[model samples]
Target: MRIIFLGTSAGRPTKARNVTSIALKLPDPANGFWLIDCGEGTQHRLLSSKLKLNRLERILITHLHGDHIYGLPGLLTSRSYFDGAGPLQIYGPIGIRAYLEGVFEHSGVHLEYELDFIEIDSTGIIAQDDGFIVEAAPLEHRMPSYGYRITELPQPGHLDLTKLAELKVPPGPLYGRLKRGEDVKLAGGVIIRSSDVVGPSVPGRIVTILGDTKPCGNAVILAQGADLLVHEATFGAGMEEKAEAYGHSTVLQAAEIAAKAGVRQLLLTHFSSRFDDEAVEKLTADAQTIFPDTVAARDYLEIHVPRMGSNASSV
Candidate 1:
């Protein structure tokens, strides 16, 4: 899995960064990508990256804040020009559906694909498919905001090639069946059980993405044991008072949440445009004081989620 930061600024766009947007690319190219927080000018940002609008499958909006959703109508309309023709599901807070509908209706914009809008209220599982399960939790913000937890389902165990060879299994269709944990009959009339050769099942990965929020319990709950915790740090380390006043979090606060939740990696985004390079560096340093594996996100920055057994880092 890969994480691409399309826009990392908070509230508004800066010459250095845009607004809030994130792209989560699946392992399979055919699966396309999932978008989080389509802020203004998001489509223009996409054009600069390798991301294709037509390949966007699902869009998860955290809140109705303009910085988080103003680009939806434009993105939706422009998608058709990219040959986008499939079902696109968008999940968000209560007013999201009405907001999109209002925009589309007012502008007379038509989409080539089916648009599915799901409004989330309380905390619970929102989406579950064969590959992943998505959960949402209400967060502490001025408006109705939410945080999302995405977990990839457990994968099948690896087949022990040494054990299979020891069983005199030939390199043929039988290998596929054995790997699938199905008992296969050999030419010699011997039945081979997959359990005898397969390793333990690999645990899935968990990724948590939070919207604009102050320090809250829901942040820790949704981020528990996550491989990557994408939290908004709209203020610098020492700006806790200011952050709280604005219903936002400081870098230190976000780092504390990651540490408390036992998350492996902490990624800080949605930065205030007022932060210069020196201030941003101080925020990163302060966040690292609480959580060593923390990264300050910049626009267009790409981070690969470490495989189950690997170390997490930005590519």
Candidate 2:
């Protein structure tokens, strides 16, 4: 999986960054991509990106804040023009459906595809399927906000080619059957069990993306053991007071959460525009003091989340 940051600024767009939009692109085209938080000008950002808007299959809104959702109506409208004819699922806090309906109705806009909205007012598993599961938890923000924990379901292990070859198993359709954990009987009446020729299943990746929030217990719980933790750092290290007043987190606080959660990678976004390159560098350095594997994200930055071995924890 890959993560593309389209906007990384806090509150509003700046010359260097835009506000709060990130795309989680899965390897499979059928699964498409999932968007988190679409701020104003998000469609323009997508236009500039190498990614195709038509491949966006789901959108997860963090809150109703303008910096997080102002671009939803325009993005949905533009997607229709780009042949995005597939059903799109959207998950967000309560009032999201009403907000979108009001906007679309007032603007007299129509969509070409189906839209499914799942309004989350409490913490629990929001989505679960054969391939993955998504859970949400309330966050400490000025308004109702949430953090999402996306856990990829564990997959069956690879077929043991060496074992099959040693067994004189001819390479054919039977190989596929054995790979799928089915017993196959050869023409000679020899039965081969899949488990005997397949390795153990490998664990899946865990990713946690949080909305604008202060350092809280839920944030730590949601991020625990995550391969990648995407959190907002709307202020520098010494600006905790200002961060608290604004219902945001400082770089240090973000790093602290990642450290406490035992996360492997920490990607910090939603930066304040006031921080120049040098200031941003200082902020990142400060975060590294608490969590070494910390990255202060920039717009258009691409991150490929790593996959671990079977020993890694899975949901």
Candidate 3:
């Protein structure tokens, strides 16, 4: 999977950054995009990119802050302008229904497709299916907030065709059966074990995307053993007091959470407009003191979220 950051600024937009939005592009665009937080001008941000509106399948909002949610109405409506001829499933905190209902009513804009809502008022296993899961946890923002976690399902290891060929195992339905963990029995009564032909099962990848929050225990809990943590580092290390006062995290605090959570990679976003490019770099450098893989993100940045054990080849 890949993450495309549409916007990554905090509370406000700057010339270099827009507000908050992230896209988890699935193989099937019609299945829609898994969007996180539709900050103001989010649809416009997509206009500059290769993303299409009709592909937005699911939207997960972490909070009700304007910067995090203001783009929903416009995006949902603007979707009609594109080929969004189907329904959109939106997951967010409580009052999302009323909020969207009000916005559509106030603007006298009725949509052309379906609008389904899931109000996430608590933290738990918020979404799950055959392939993946999305969980939620409360965050210490001034208003009610949440952090989301995405876990992709494990995959079956690749079949070692060379092993089968070496064993004179003719490629046929028997190979398919063996790949599904069944021992293949040849008409000659030769039995081949699946273990000899397949490696271990592929492990799933864990990703935690945090909303605006302070250095709270919940952050660490949600981020445990994550492959990638998209967290908010709104301030520098020396500004911890300001960070706390504003209910946000400094670079050091974010790093400490990543370190404690044993995360493999840390990607920072939602930066305060106060810090410019150079300052954000300095802030990430400080975070690396606690976790070396820490990086501060910018708008339109592309990050490859590898499926677990793809390169390492370990389950």
Candidate 4:
């Protein structure tokens, strides 16, 4: 899986940053992506990449703020233009269905694909499909907002071809059995044990994304041992007063959260427009003081979640 940032600026777009939108690409899945927070110009960002928007199955909205979802109607219309297929499931806090409906109604926009919206109020698992599960928690925003956690289930252990070849077993159901940790009995009392062929199952990966929120109770739990954490640092350490007043976290606060949660990698995004090019480095430096694996998020940044036994690194 990979995370591609479309817009990372907070409040408004600046010379170096846009707004808030991210695409989580699961190339192996039938529905390839979980598109989160379609800020303005998100379609333009999509057009710049080779990612197929038609493969998008889930759209997660953190809040109803314009900076978070102004690009929805445009993206949905653009999907129709591209002949997108399948229902688009969207999850938000509340009033999101009406909000989108009102926007489409006022704008006279129509679509050919189904659009599903789930507006929730409490913390719980929101969606589960294949081997992935997504959970939502309320965030401390000016408006009713939410943060999402995505967990990738571990895959079956790799098959041992050499062992099978030694056993003179041809390619067939025996390989499947070994991969699933099942011992297979061959003809003439020849038994092959799964322990002798299959390797250990890999650990699952977790990604936690917090939108426009302050450090709160659920944030740490949601981020515990996460592979990658995308949190908003709207203000730098210099503006802690403003950050607290607005229910937003500063750079240091974000780092503190990552350290406490024991996340492998920390990505600081949703930066205030006041600090653009210089802000990335300055805030990144401040965050590094707390956690060594901290990084400032930039527009169009591509982050890869490491494979089994691979080390995690910031993009």
Error of 1 at 211 (Å): 0.4
Worst 10 residues of 2 by lDDT: 306-315
Worst 10 residues of 3 by lDDT: 306-315
Clashing pairs in 2: none
lDDT string for model 4 (1-315, tens) is 889999999989987788899999884635478788999989888988768778888899999899999998888887876664678898997888998899999989888888998998999999987778999999887888888999988777777788789998768887887788888888867988888888878777899998789888788988999999999999888788898799899999999999999999999999888885875797899899999898777888888898657976545
Give the candidates in order of lDDT, highest first.
1, 2, 4, 3
The model with the greater TM-score, 2 or 3, is 2
Clashing pairs in 1: none
Best by lDDT: 1
lDDT of 3 at 50: 81
C-alpha lDDT of residue 38 in model 4? 91
Comparing candidate 1 with candidate 2, which one achieves the higher TM-score?
1
Error of 4 at 159 (Å): 1.4
Q: Give RMSD (Å) of candidate 4 vs. truth.
A: 1.8
lDDT of 3 by residue, 206-227 (tens): 8899989998988998999989
lDDT of 1 by residue, 1-315 (tens): 889999999999989999999999987734689999999999999999888887898999999989999998999998877774588999999989899889889989888788998999999999998889999999999999999999988877988998889999998888888777799888889999989988888888899999999999999999999999999999886677898888999998999999999999999999898987677888899999989999889988899887678877776
lDDT of each: 0.91, 0.90, 0.86, 0.87
TM-score of each: 0.96, 0.95, 0.91, 0.94
Clashing pairs in 4: none
